[model samples]
Target: MDELARRSFVAAVLGAVFFGGPAVAQNTTAGGVTRVALKGYDPVSYFTDGVPQQGSAEFTFAFDDTTYWFKSAEHRTTFAADPEHYAPQFDGFCAVLLSRGRKVEADPEAWTINNGKLYVFSGKRGVLSFNERPIDIAQRAGENLKQLR
Candidate 1:
């Protein structure tokens, strides 16, 4: 195989084995669970109601190999209009864990929206640590996500 093709093949294999699937597989984590981003929470609610509202499968949209639930057709439309703007950072994985270069399940109830970005936590500890140093941790998490994506 040619060098470029070989490099791409190797990268694809390594990414799938180490980081789930392709870089667009941001909805998934390293643990191999094709996690539904925000865990069925209504992404629009965070902006509209300022809370994490449970979403219904009836109002859903599929993106990046993951299904996102919404509270209403309006919410679904809103999300579909601009998923990147609404989707959680690091595919809804714990922001704190991402900062530490780890992938873990997130607790929907434990969330934060910093500068129009949604970030969820795996647990209370994640929330605490993220809150303690949000800027630095978020920066590190952003860098880590760049590599993952």
Candidate 2:
């Protein structure tokens, strides 16, 4: 297979294993248009301005066949306004691993926020593990992300 094809195929497999769905669901706004969360329920719109916007500003990357939206237009306007507060770490990756100085793809449903930073995990179970060591996980993830780049 060609390089791009190989990459696409790998991405597909990884997405399926990590995201837990072949077709990710798009979380919509109160108006019920545009996509958010890729396949999970974020509800940031309701929290921010009682409405969801077109997209998130932190990292606009397509995931699980859908686009992930942000907290509000303010998120887009500033691009750094509470980034850790809104942006999913490690591109929506597993939080526990982040805390362990590693990065792994996560299931959208498994999520939590600490110090305003959004953390995603492989599943509810992983989240539990993360909860057990929030500070350590946060510190490790912060240090590990630099190496990933």
Candidate 3:
């Protein structure tokens, strides 16, 4: 294979092992069972590809950490141009918890998106619990965030 192809192949393998599938390939069954699992925090950070960009209808940060290969400088630049439109809510924390007067970190394994908003949880257990009644959890979370500020 050519050099570029070889490099891409290597990158893809590493990506699957480390970052899981492409950001779009993330699993949302429940219990934060995403491909990767983050340390110091829940697995959702790994599943959602490390939060999303808010505001401008994008999904990634402008200046993403080099840990994940974003594919282009322009992609990063676009994220930088207007981050509020792209940054994930609560830095990829558990949206349910955030709306519920708490600040629980997320596990990348359990994740989902509703109307462009990413919701992450601790793991398969967490995802299943959240899925039992997403609306109620979401509503409570919304009320909780309102009290924060």
| lDDT top scorer | 1
The alpha-carbon lDDT assigned to residue 7 of candidate 1 equals: 50
- What are the TM-scores, per candidate, against the unseen true structure? 0.70, 0.49, 0.43
TM-score, prediction 2: 0.49
Q: Write the per-residue lDDT of candidate 1 for residues 28-71, one digit (tens) a residue.
A: 54687655778889978988899999998676665544667788
lDDT of 3 by residue, 46-132 (tens): 223554322211222211111222334344344333333433444455776775678666665567665555567756665676678
For model 2, the stretches where C-alpha displacement exceeds 4 angstroms are 1-81
Stretches > 4 Å off in candidate 1: 1-34, 146-149
lDDT of 1 at 10: 42
Query: Cα RMSD (Å) between model 1 and the true structure?
Result: 9.2
| Candidate 1 lDDT | 0.74
lDDT of 3 at 127: 66
Reference-based lDDT, each prediction:
0.74, 0.53, 0.46
**Rank order by lDDT, top first?**
1, 2, 3
Look at candidate 2 and tell me the lDDT of residue 20.
51
Which stretches of model 3 miss by more than 4 angstroms? 1-74, 81-86
lDDT of 2 by residue, 1-149 (tens): 34575457446544553555442223343567744442433425423653323443443323323345544434332323233345566656576776676666676656666666667787789878878888887678777876764
Better-scoring candidate (TM-score), 1 or 3: 1
